[model samples]
Target: MNFLKSTYGAMMLVGLLAVSCNRDEDMQQGTDTEEEQAVETSSEGEDASDDALEMAYQGEHQLSVSGGRVKNTLCATVTNDKVNKIITIDFGDGCVGPYGRERKGKIFIAYSSEVGDSIANRIITFGDFFVNNKGVTGTIELRDVSINADGNLQSTKRLKDLTITFPNGQKVVYNGSRTREWLAGAGDDDPTNNKYKITGTVTGESTTGRSFTQEIVEPIIADWSCAAQGNFARVSGVVEMTKLNGYSVRKRTVYYGDGECDNVITITTFRRTYTITVDN
Candidate 1:
C-alpha cells in the first residue's frame, strides 16, 4: 500500500510539471506570433504612406510668365512628383511685340530632395538668350529668392545686379539670405494711420573680384484718409547704402500705385498713378 501511494504522488508531480511546461511554450509561441503580426502591420502602413506621397505630387499645372520684360504668353507644367518642371515660351503672335520674341529661349528647373526647401539650392537651368549686351553661355544656379510661409517676395539681388552685367565672362552669385519685418501703427503721433516700417540686409559676392554688403532700414507711411478716393498720402523714412560698394543711394518717395498698400513694397524708379478702390 505504501509503495502504491508513493507512485501515485510521483505521477501527479510529473503530470503537473508537463502541464506547466506546455503552458509556457504556448505563451511563448503566442508572443512571437503577436510580434510578427505587429511588424507586418507596420510595414504595410509604411508602404501605404509612401504610395500616397508618391501619388500626391503627380500632375501638371500651367505656369505663365508676365510683367517685367517677359512679354511672351508662355506655359509650363509641373510633373514627376513635383521634382521636375519645364517652361516653354511661345513668343506668341507678332502682335505680342519684340520682348516676347526674345523669350523663345528654353528654361528647365529641377528640384532635389537633398535641398531642404524648393527655393533653396534649386537647380534652375537657363538656355541661350541675348538681352542688351549680356549673352548667355552656361547654366548658372538661380539663388537668393526666398518664398516664406506668407508667400512674400524677398530677394538679396541689389539694384545694381538687376541692371548691370559683369564685363568679365564670369557670373555674379548671390549667396546670402534676408528676412523683412514690417510694423504698422507703432507711434501714437504718426499722421499716417497706415504707418509701417521695413528692415533687412543683403550680402553677396561678385565674380569680378568685388564683394558687396547692403543694409536697408526704411519706414512706409500711408495716409488712408485719401485712400477711399483712389489716392494715397505717402512718405518714406528710410536710408539704404552699400558700405564698400559703389551703388545708387536709396531715397524716399511718395506712393502712387493702387497696389502699394501692402508692406511688401516694390521700389521702382518709375512713377505712375492709378485709381485704387479700397475693399472693406
Candidate 2:
C-alpha cells in the first residue's frame, strides 16, 4: 500500500546518503587482469562460484551468495520488542554488492514461531524491509522467511510495482518472487563455514516505461572467492531477456566486479568473450 511513497523515500535516502560515504577508487587495472583470467577460465575449468545479490545488514566480512565476502558498511541495530511481538532491524549504512549497491534502511517483521537468542528457521511474514543509500533503493515485502539451522536465509520477497532506478534516469520495475539463499560463508584461509552466495529471480521490465520478461536459465553465479586481497567477484549465467533496452536476446552474461562495493560489475556475454563496464 505504501510502496510508492517508500520508494520515493528510499530515493531521497540515497540522495542524502550519497554525500556522506567515502567514494571508491578506480578499478581499471583490476578489470584488465580479470578479463585476461576469464579468457583462460574456459580452458582451465569452471570458476569458483557466483555471488549473492541479496543484502542483509549482518556483519563485516560476511560471506556473499556469490562466493565472495561482504563488508557491511552499516552495522544495523537489531531490536525485538517482546511486548509487541515485533522484530525491528535497522540497516543503517552498508554496501550490498554484486548488485543492489550500498544501502541503509530498516526491516520490521513479526514471527509466528518462537524466536530465541538465535533465530533459526523462524517463519516470519509481514516484513517491512527497505534498503537504499547509494547504488540501490527499494522496499521488500516479506511474504515468508526462514533461516536454516546453518544460518542460511531462505525466503520469498514481494515486489509490487517496485521501481529500481539506475544512474541514467532509467528504471526497472521489479514485480516477482525473490526467492533467496545464503550460498557460501565467510572464509579466510579456506574457512569452511560462514554466509555467502545468493540466488533468485525478479521478472519484469528491464527499464522504466518498458514491458518485457527476463528469466535466468539457471542460478546466476555470484562469485566472491576466498582471497582476502583483490577486488574480484563475478555474476555469471545464461538469461533469456526479451526486453533489455528493447532487444529480444537470450545470452549468457558474465559480470566481473572490482569488489569495491560500488555496484559496478563488468558485463561479459556469450561464452566468456567480451567485456563492458557497468552503465558505461
Candidate 3:
C-alpha cells in the first residue's frame, strides 16, 4: 500500500505538529512554564500511537498463523490469529526506525468482526509499548466504520484514558472522540494520495497539572500526498485549546496554514500570536 511510502514522513511530521514553546520569545516570562513541554509530549505520544496503529492496519493482511511478518523500518514481527481476530505487531527489544526513533514492545489490534462487515470496529491496545522510551498505555477504539454519503469511508474514534508517560516520569492523560471521514482517494489503493477530514474534541490533563479541552473549530484536512513530498500532512485546520481554571479559561488557538504543505503554523493566544517554523 502507498502508506508504506508515506507513513514514515507523516509520522515524522507528527512530531513537528506537537506545539513546542522551547523558544524563549514564544511566550511571556513564566506563563504556564510547563505547558509547552507538556503539550508537546502529549501530542507526540498521541501521534506516535496513531502512526503505529496505521502501520499495523495497512500490513495486517501480511500476518498469518505461521509466524508471518511484514517488512518495515521498525523490523517488527507480525502475527495474527484469524480465529480470534487479533493482529499483533511486535518490536522486540528495541529497534531504530525512521528518523532514528526507537520503539519497543508490542501493539495489539483486535477486530470486533470481519473487516468487510457493515458494522465493525477496530480496537487497539498496547503491551508495554514504548516509543522513544516513553511508555504509552490506552485503548483506541474505532467503531461504526462505514462509507458515508460522499462515498468516503467514515468512522468514529474513541480514545479511552490514553496515557503517555515520559522518560522523566511525568504523565499525561488524554480522552476524546473524533469523527474521521476519508475525503479523497478512498476508492483508490494509493494511500499516498489519501486525504481525510477530521473533526473532534479532545480533553486532556498536561503534565503540569493543567486541564485543557481542545476542539477542532475547523475541520482538519489531512493530505498524505503532502507528506509524501516531505511536508506537513495537515494542510489546513484551526484548533482551539482551552485550559480550565476554576471559573476562568485560557484559550490558545492553533492555525495550520492555508492549504499549504509547508511546515509553518500560527499559534494565537490572548497574549499574542506567534508564528512557528516547524522543522521537517
Candidate 4:
C-alpha cells in the first residue's frame, strides 16, 4: 500500500508538470501573435497617413464669372503640390469686345491666410486695352474678400482703394463703391448713326475733386446742301461737360469733310472729358 501511494503521487506530479508546460507554451504563442498583430496595424495606419498627406499636398481649382451688362467670363486652373505649383487663367475670347478692341491683361493673384479672416487683401494689375490705341492700366487693392476652406476665392469684397494709370502717365486715385460692368459690345457698334454714352468719376491724388461726362456719336452732317454746291459738308455740335462739384460746361466744335452729295462718309469719334482739381 505504501508503494502504490508513492507511485500515485509521482504520477500526479508528472501530470501537473505536463499541464504547466502546455499552458506556458500557449501563453508565449499568444503573446507573439498579439505583438505581430500590433505591428501590422501600425504599419497600415502609417500607410494611410502617408496617403492622406500626399492628397492634401496636391489640389486642382478653377474660377469663373458671368452676368451684368458686360458678358465677361474668366477661368483658371491651379495645380498645387509639395514641390511646385502652377496656375493658368483663361479670360475667354471676346471677354472685352470686338477685334482690336479687347480686354487683354495680366491678373496677379497673391494671398495670405495667416491674417485674420475679416480681411483678405489682393492686388490686381491691368496691362492694357486692345482697342482705341489707348490702354487702361490700374491697380486695385481689395480687402475683406471671402474664401473657402481650401483657400479658394468665394467673392470680391469692398474696394479699399484704386489707382489708375493711363498710358499717357495720367494717374487717378479713388476710394468709393466701384463695380465692373462687362459690356458685350461696348465700343464696337456701327459707326454710321450709333450713339453711346459713358459716365464715371475718379477721386485720388490726381483727381481728388473731379468728375466727367462723355458722349460718343457716329457720323452726322448738318449742312448737306453745301456738298451739292461743290462745297465741304460740316458737322456742328455742343458737348456738355462737368467737373466734380462744379457747373457744367458746353463746348462747341465744327467738323468738315470734302465729299459729294451722292456719297456719304461714316466717321466715329471717341470723346472724353476730365474735371481735375489741382492740389494746393
Candidate 5:
C-alpha cells in the first residue's frame, strides 16, 4: 500500500472533530499551558470541551485501513481546566488490517486553549502530541492552531522529527503540516442536514524528498451518543482521497454506522463495500 492510502483512515477519522464549540469564542488569559507526561493512574480525571466535542474525544475515533477490521480504545479527560486536556487513543497492539499492514500505537495529545489574535479561534491548541502508528512515532507541533469561534479548525499543524519504522527494519523520517476545518453543518440536530463535517489540507514532505499534498474529504455528519470508557461510534458520509503526487483524486469512501456502542462500521469505496468491526 502507498503512504497516503495506508494511513488515510487514521488522519481522516480524527479530523472529524474540527467543528466549533457552539460558535462562541471562549477566550481566556493565562490559560494553563503545560504538558504532563504523567499518565493519570485513574482513567477519569477532569472535564473539558463542550458536550459534542467532549463526547467525541472521550469516545475516540479509529479506522481500519483494509478489509480486515480492528478495534481500539480512547481516553480523554481534562488534566486541569477546559484549556488543558489529555486525549489518548490506543489502536491496540499490532493489529492487522490488510495489505501486510500491522500497527500498534497509542496517540497521546496534550493541549491548551487560548484566544488567538488572527487565524483560528485559538480555543484549544496542542502543546504536545505523539502519534504512534505502524511503528511510526510522530511528534505533533500545533502552532497557532485553533478551532475558530465558528468551530472551523484554523491552524497549521507541524509534524516534526517523525520516524516510521517498517517491518523490514527500514525507517523514513518526515516533517509536514496539515491544516483542518469544519466544512458544513454546525450542531447535532440532523445527520443529513446538520452534520458536523470537517476537512483538512496536508502539505509536507519526508526526509527522503517525498513531497505530498493531501486534501481530506469531510464526513457527512458526526455521532456522539455513545460515551462510556472511551468507546466512540461514528459514521462518515463520503470521503475523497486526493494524491498530490501528480494532482489526482484517487478514491472516494463512504461510511455507515450501526449507531450502536458495538462500534462496527460499514465502509464503501468505489462500489466495493468493506465491513469494519471496531471495538474498544
Candidate 6:
C-alpha cells in the first residue's frame, strides 16, 4: 500500500511539471508573435508616411516650377497658397497611386519657403488619411532642409504622436526623429529615380500594447525605383528593435538585404532568426 501511494504521487508530480512547461512555452510563443507584429506594423506606418512626404514635395516642386499654374495631377488634387507657401493635397474618396497602394483623405504642407531651399522647414499634417484601409494620424515636420557637406540635400524628419490603426482595430503609436539625405536623382523629372538614405531612432507602443525602441544601426536606403516596381521602399539597412516587456526582454535585429529590390527581410530574435516576405 505504501509503495502504491508513492508511485501515484510521483505520477501526479510529473503531470503537473509537464503542464507548467507547456504553459511557459505557449506564453513565449505568444510574445514572439507580438514582437513581430509590432515591428511589421510600425514599418508599414513609416512607409505610408514616406510616400505622403514625397507626394507633397513633388506637388510643391511642380507648383514652384510652373509658377503656381498646375493644380491637379494624376496622383491627387493639389491646392497651394503662394503667399503662405502652403500646399494641400486631397486624395478624396480613394485612388490607386504608385506602387498599387490606395490612398484617401488629405495632406497639408506648410513650407517655410521653397521645399529644397536652404534652412527651409515644411510642416506636414494629415486630414482623415487612410492608406490601404489603415488610418494614419500624425504630424511629420521636415526641418532645416539644406545641402550637406557631401553635396546632398538633407532634412530632419520629425514625427509626433503618429498613430497607425489597422483594419482589425489594432493601433500602433510611433514617435521619432530621423535624418534623410537625398543621395541621387534629385534633378530627374521621374520620381521613381529618387533615392534617399535614412538614419534614425524610433520608440513606440505596438498594437499589442508592447513598447519597443528601434534604432537604425545602418542607414536605410529608400529607393523609389524599387517601390515603383512593386517592391518594398526600403532596399537595404539594419534595424535593432528591443521590446520592453513580456516573459523577457526581446531584441530583434532586422536585415533588409544588400540593396535588393525584393520584399524579403530577415529578423533575428533571441530564440531564432526568420525571414518574411512583406506585401508592400
- Per-residue CA lDDT of model 4 for 27-72, tens digit only, reads 4443323322222221111111111111111111122122112222
**lDDT for every model?**
0.31, 0.39, 0.68, 0.29, 0.34, 0.79
- What TM-score goes with each of the models? 0.31, 0.47, 0.74, 0.27, 0.35, 0.83
lDDT (10s digit) by residue, model 6, range 221-251: 9998998898888989988886544446656
lDDT of 3 by residue, 230-265 (tens): 566677888877763321367777787789887677
Rate residue 275 of model 2 by lDDT.
49
Top lDDT hit: 6
Taking all chains together, the TM-score of candidate 4 against the true structure is 0.27
| TM-score of candidate 2 on Cα atoms, chains taken together | 0.47
Off by over 4 Å in 2: 1-74, 91-102, 114-154, 186-201, 223-234, 244-274, 278-280
Residue pairs of candidate 6 with colliding backbone atoms: none
- Which tens-of-lDDT digit does each residue in 225-280 have in candidate 1? 33323332332333232332222333322222343533222232222222222111
Q: Which model, 4 or 6, shows the larger TM-score? A: 6
Candidate 5 has an lDDT of 0.34
lDDT of 1 at 183: 30
The residue-by-residue lDDT of candidate 5 on 41-138, one tens digit each, is 00000111112233223322222111122333332222222244444434344443211223334444444432112232222222222222224454
| Candidate 4 local distance difference test against the native | 0.29
For residues 186-246, what per-residue lDDT tens digits would candidate 2 score against the true structure?
Answer: 3342322333433455555533233444454455444444222222333444434433332
Itemize residue pairs with steric clashes in candidate 5: 20-151, 121-148
Q: Comparing 2 and 5 by lDDT, which wins?
A: 2
Task: For candidate 4, give the lDDT of residue 138.
Answer: 42
Q: Give the residue spans of candidate 5 off by over 4 A.
A: 1-136, 146-197, 203-214, 220-230, 244-249, 254-262, 269-271
What are the runs in model 1 whose C-alpha is more than 4 Å off? 1-72, 75-101, 111-123, 129-172, 179-199, 206-208, 219-239, 245-280
Residue 270 in model 4: lDDT: 22
